[model samples]
Structure formats: C-alpha cells, structure tokens
Target: MWELRHRGGGGPGPGGEAASPPREGEAAGGDHETESTSDKETDIDDRYGDLDSRTDSDIPEIPPSLDRTPEILKKALSGLSSRWKNWWIRGILTLTMISLFFLIIYMGSFMLMLLVLSIQVKCFHEIITIGYRVYHSYDLPWFRTLSWYFLLCVNYFFYGETVADYFATFVQREEQLQFLIRYHRFISFALYLAGFCMFVLSLVKKHYRLQFYMFAWTHVTLLITVTQSHLVIQNLFEGMIWFLVPISSVICNDITAYIFGFFFGRTPLIKLSPKKTWEGFIGGFFSTVIFGFIAAYVLSKYQYFVCPVEYRSDVNSFVTECEPSELFQLQSYSLPPFLKAVLRRETVSMYPFQIHSIALSTFASLIGPFGGFFASGFKRAFKIKDFANTIPGHGGIMDRFDCQYLMATFVHVYITSFIRGPNPSKVLQQLLVLQPEQQLNIYKTLKTHLTEKGILQPTLKV
Candidate 1:
C-alpha cells in the first residue's frame, strides 16, 4: 500500500534519493508532463465514462484562452452583423443614387444626353461583368475574356461619342434622320454577327448545350434592350411622356410591391423566387395604375409645350441690302401656314377624364411586373442569386432597369399608336397635298444637299 501511495503521488520511489520540490524550470516541465498524461487519461476515461461513473468536472481544466466555444460563436455573430450593417448602408446609398440619377435624366434634353450615354455605358460594363462571372463559373475561360473585351468595344464605339454625334446630326433634319436610322440597322447587324462569333469561339467541351442556350438567351435579351432604347430615342421621348411615365410607373410598382410584401405577404407568387408574394403583386398592380392616370392627366395639361416647334425664313427677293446674319435671324422669319394653323388651335387642353386612365394604369402595372418576373426567371435558370450586390437593396442594374425596358417599350408603342395618332411626318405629307412629281423633286433636292454635305454617302442605298 505504501509503494502504491509513492507511485500515485508522482514522486521517486522510497529507495531512491529523498524526494524534493523541483527547481522552477524543472517544476514547470514536470507539471507539463503530468498534465499531458492527465489529458490522455482523461480522454481514455471519457471514452469509458459513458458506461461508468465519471462526471465532466473530473476532466482537467484547459487554459481559458483555449476555450473556443464562446470565441467561435462571437466571431460568427460579428461577421453576420457586419454583413447586415453593410447591406443596410448600401441600401440607403442606392436609394440616393437612384433618386439623383432619375432627377438628372428627367430634367431636360441636355441632361438626358449626359445621363443616357453615361448610364448606358456603365450598364454595358455591368452586363459584361455579369457575363464574365457566369461564363467563368462554368470554366469557359475563352468566353470570360472575349466577352469582356467585346463589351468594352461596344460601350466605346457603339454607345460612345461617335453614336451621340451621329444621333445629334441625324435629328437635325427629317430626311437625314431617316437615312441615319437605315445606317444604324447595318451597324446593328454587324454587332449581332460579332456577338455570335464570340459566343461560338467561347464554347467549352461538354458545355456546348449550355453555350447554345446562353447565346440564344443573350441575343434575345440584347435585342429587347436595343429595341427599347431605340424606340425611346426615336420618339424624342427624352423628358415628357416617354421619360416621366415609365419612371413614375416603375417607382410606384416597386414601392407598392415592397410595402405589401413586407406587411401582408404570405403566399409565394412563384416557387423559384420565394420572396415574391401574391399580395405584393396585387398591390403593385393597383399602384402602377393609379400613377399612370396621374401621369396622363399631368401630361395632357402640359401638352402645348410638348409639341415640336418649327421656324421658317421669309426672304424679300427685291431687297438686296440685307446682311447675311440678319437673313438668318428670327426677325426675318414668318410662321409657315402650318405653324400659323397650329398656333390658332386651342392650347393647354386637357383630355376628358375617363376609364382610359385606369386602363393605362393597369397596363403599366401588369407589364412592368412581368419584366421583373422574366428577370427572376433568368436568374433562377442561371443559378445566380443577384446580378450584382451593387445596389444593396436593389441588387444590380439589371434588377432596377429590368422592368423599365419592357415598360418603356410598351408605353412608347401605346402612345404612338393611340394617344399621338399617325406619324407626324406621314401626316404632314398627307396634309400638304403634294403631287407625286413634286414629292420626288423635294426628296431628290434634300438627298442632293445631304450627299454634297458628306452626311449621306454614295454607298447608302437610300
């Protein structure tokens, strides 16, 4: 029993030198060895203790710093909180940015010029980045790089200063504008061809099917975006109905959807996008319709200033003393008979308030939400969460502008066909009652002038 006590005491046996407390260093080393042995024994005991009588407290205490449970949990919660805070901040910033962007864009023609060019370029870059991420995820390295460069070129050339100058010049004359549109078609065809070539060259081995689908999807999306943009520009819808209606409708829809979704959303609108709710859909629809009516009423009240103004010069052939600059001045002008007739017409007339407002409102609401749904479908198919995290609450450019693309297209078409009536140029030609020969002469004269000015080239079929 004494020998057993000496062994359990963790000291030398009795026959050896008398046991003494170790030096400081030796004592630490001894304690370490003992602790290590204790740890092993504890582990073994733990393995058997489940079937025995040992309790948790029997296990030796480790250093407080080594107790990782609270530390791990704290770290996890800190990271999550930080992410939440960042998203919150981002949401606020995005709201400000969007509000400012819309205000600047809707102010006037000059503002439209700056906003459209700059924002579209930024949007193109964002699109290219999204494409790169998508392609890279599938390990298509070639497409990842090729798409980036191609989009860069598109933003630089097609959407750059050259196109702006072309558009500005084209709009200066009706005949030149028609010619410019025809020219633009050729450029568009070239871009399509280039896009197809890049898609083909970026193909991966087993991903051929995916590549095909992606190509087709991209083409459709690009066509939609381009067509919408063209329609908006051609209508000169820079500030009035074109700009105001779509922007207001989209905002109303978004706000209504969020409010309803936050408060009353329960039933999922679609399984793919779990957050979207039926309540939100209904609320957004109603809101959009209400906003549309308000827009129409306001626009109709301000319709006089919305009409395009034309000026004509009247020259006195008998007077040879007129200065060249004086000849070009407004004082030398007489309002054309057409202009005089328009001036005589009643001004600032409001449309009769009718159910048309409700129809317009409902149409805007339905179509805009459909755009959002379509974008959601695309994201789900591609296995992407968001286009980007740029907007905080908004997601990305695609997210914010998705509904606008479709809404603008529908609004432009609707206004042109119903509210605006026949094309202005066609109506003017019809009203003038020119003979075929006279019309031909006018066309030839305009074409000749434009050709001589180098605005229309010999290669142009028109």
Candidate 2:
C-alpha cells in the first residue's frame, strides 16, 4: 500500500536521492525496472495540470452528418437515398435563399447593407464559437466578452467608414454623426484599445498562451468576416450589378460544379475537398462565365440595376439613379479574325461590364472553391463537420458564404485595378465635408482652371 502510494503520489524514490524526471523523448513505462517512469509522469502532470486539463479538449469521433434533411422533407422523401435526400434539401434551401436575396435587392440598398451586416455578424459568431470550442477556455476571464467587444469595435470602424464615404450628404445633416465621422478612426482605435487593455488585465498565468491564441483568433476572424463584408458593401455602392454579378457567378459555379460532380465526378480535384472533381471544376468554369456574361447584359439594360446607390439630399433618402457609366454603356468590340470567321461577324456590341464579367466569373470558378476548401480544412483540423447547424443542409451561413467573401475581395481588387476610375461624385462628397473656407478655395482653384481652359467665361475683377 505504501509502495502504491509512493508510485502514485509522485514522491521521492526509495533511495534518498530524488528520482530524475523522465526525459522528454521517453514514454510512460510499466516494468518495475522503470518504476520511476509513472512517478515522473505524475510529477509532470502535477506541474502542468491546469494547462493539460484544458488542452486535452478533443472533439469526440463522430461520422459526418451533412444530410440534415428537414422533418417534412424527410417524411416526404423517405423513399429516397440519403444522397438524393440531401440534394433535395440543399436545392430547396438554395432557391429559398436566392428568392430571399431578390426580395432584399427589391427592398433596396439599405436592406442589402443590412443583409451584409447580418451575415457578417453570423459568420463572426460561427468562427468565434469554433475558437472557443477548440480552446475550451470557458474559465478564462472575459474571453467571450472580449471577442464580442472587438467585433463591435470592428463593425463601428468599418460601418462608420462606409457611412462617411457613401453617405456623406446624409451624415452632414446629423450633428452627432458628423462628429463621429470626423474622428472615426480615432474613436475606433480608442474602442479597440479598451478591449486590448481589458484582455491584458484578464490574463491568467497558466492560460496565458491560450488567451493570446484566442486574441489572435478573434482579430483574424474580424479580418475575414468584417473586412470582406465591408468590401462587399463597397461593391454594392459601385452598382447593384457590380455586387450581383460576382456573387451570382460564385453561386452559379458552386451549384453547377456540385451538380456536375454529382453526376460525373471521378478524378478527385483536391485532397482538402474529397468530393470536388476536375469534371465539376471545368463544368463550373464554363457555366459561370456564360452566366456572368448573360446576367451582366440583362442588368446593364436597367438604369435601376446599373446605377450607383447614392444619397439624394433633395429627396432626403438614398437613391440609385445616374447616367450609366461607360461600363454599363454598350460598346462595340472587334472579334479576333478566327472568332469573326467562325461567327461571321466582325464586331459585337456589348456592355463593357459583360467583358469584365468574364474575368470575375473565371476567378469565381477557378479560385473561389479554394476558399471553401480552406474552410473544409479548418473544420477538419478541429474535427468539426460544419461551422454550425444553423442551416438544415448548408451547415452554417459561413459555409455558404466562404466563397462569396473570397469573391467579394477579388471583385473589389478588380474594380480598383481595371473597372473603377476617378469619380466626380466621390470628389464632391469629399468637398462637402470640408470647411466653408476650404470649399471656397477649392471652388476658386477649380474656377480658375476652368477659365484657363475656356470652358467657363472669366469674370472681370471690379
């Protein structure tokens, strides 16, 4: 009994000399010859018990359960295999989501901004939840609170910038908002500093590493969800078509790829996403390019869809009306000789946006899936089948939007690179924010330049 106690108690050896702790390379042992092994392990456990207990958080092994068919559908399609059942569930939900999306679009730009915010919040929650689950840091003080606090700080910063940039006229009328907008970055930074100080104050000794890990995790999540969602809203303000075409291309690719893969997939595309295939990837690329071209053509014809969302101070509301940009205006393009010979046409008139859509569609098809695959690998790392069970068949909102976020970033980059040019409206918005003296100086400078160019009649000084 004393021997048992000695072995288990992690105490000194029978010899007065203390037992050396087991080497890091050696494993736990059983034989009496190595009786000290168990004692050494016990000593190590005692030394780091607090961390070991929390760090051992492993998700239990469970089979993938992506089916998640709703009860009514399950009962109705009870005869079908799980694969077909999932197909039905996903298809119905996809259409429902698209319909709801159109409804939001009809409700107008404010509603679309709200939708982006909602998705951003949900995605942030899903990712933060995963971090919490992986770390099992429930005992860590103020972590969940800090995560949410940082999220609010980020939203305030991004949305504040959006209002300042896109709603300058509207903001100018509100005194309280004017102050906030004037010093938006400083306020955002102060808010973040408060969160950072709270985090430092909340740190516990044993959980220091884990706490810092969660800190980094929260910031990375904000970068992914908040930053990309802001870019999406920026795309929306460019024109509804700017927002819609890229997103629709991704959706088109995701669906067509899945459908093609379901029917014809053989060679695996990537180890990260086992089900993705070369056949589906190729099919999705062609389908998305076609879909983007057609959608751009259709949307470009409508002033409402093609116009930038702008604040109309006269109407005291936001509006989407302006002369369509060169992008939306139809232009003639000369076909290459071979294409001209094949099609029997020398030139084709098309919206410049339709030509740009080909690039957007190509990225959505070829590169967008990598975003989804990255999410899949993240889940695999954590032994999770899904981010959350929010959507019946879609896993979570993040699952559906992973590729969309990637597409949004790409579109924003593409616009700045190729599509967007100097905007008179944006410059006017900046002028509106200036003091009267500054505005007058700019006006004088502009008038003088215009007079020199003979575009404006010069006023004689009295």
Best candidate (score: lDDT): 2
Give per-residue CA lDDT, model 1, range 1-462, as digits (tens).
Answer: 344223323566598866764433455646767766655564554443332232444333321212222344445446456546444454455578768866764464445545554545455555655554544435654554554445444444344333333234333345654444436557656765786687777776555644554455444444655556555554443224455556667877877787787678998987766878999989888777777776666654443214331222233111112222211222323456787688874333334432345655676677677777888876665456666655544666777777777766776776666655655543443423457788788779979999899999865566
Worst 10 residues of 2 by lDDT: 48-57
**lDDT tens per residue, model 2, 160-266:** 87777777767778999888888889999999999999999998766676788889999999999999999999999888898989999999999999999999999
Q: What's the C-alpha lDDT at position 422 in model 1? A: 51
Q: Estimate each model's TM-score.
A: 0.54, 0.86
Q: Model 1, 450: alpha-carbon shift in Å?
A: 28
Give the C-alpha lDDT of model 2.
0.85
In order, candidate lDDTs are 0.55, 0.85
Candidate 1 structure, TM-score to reference: 0.54
Model 1 poorest ten-residue lDDT run: 316-325
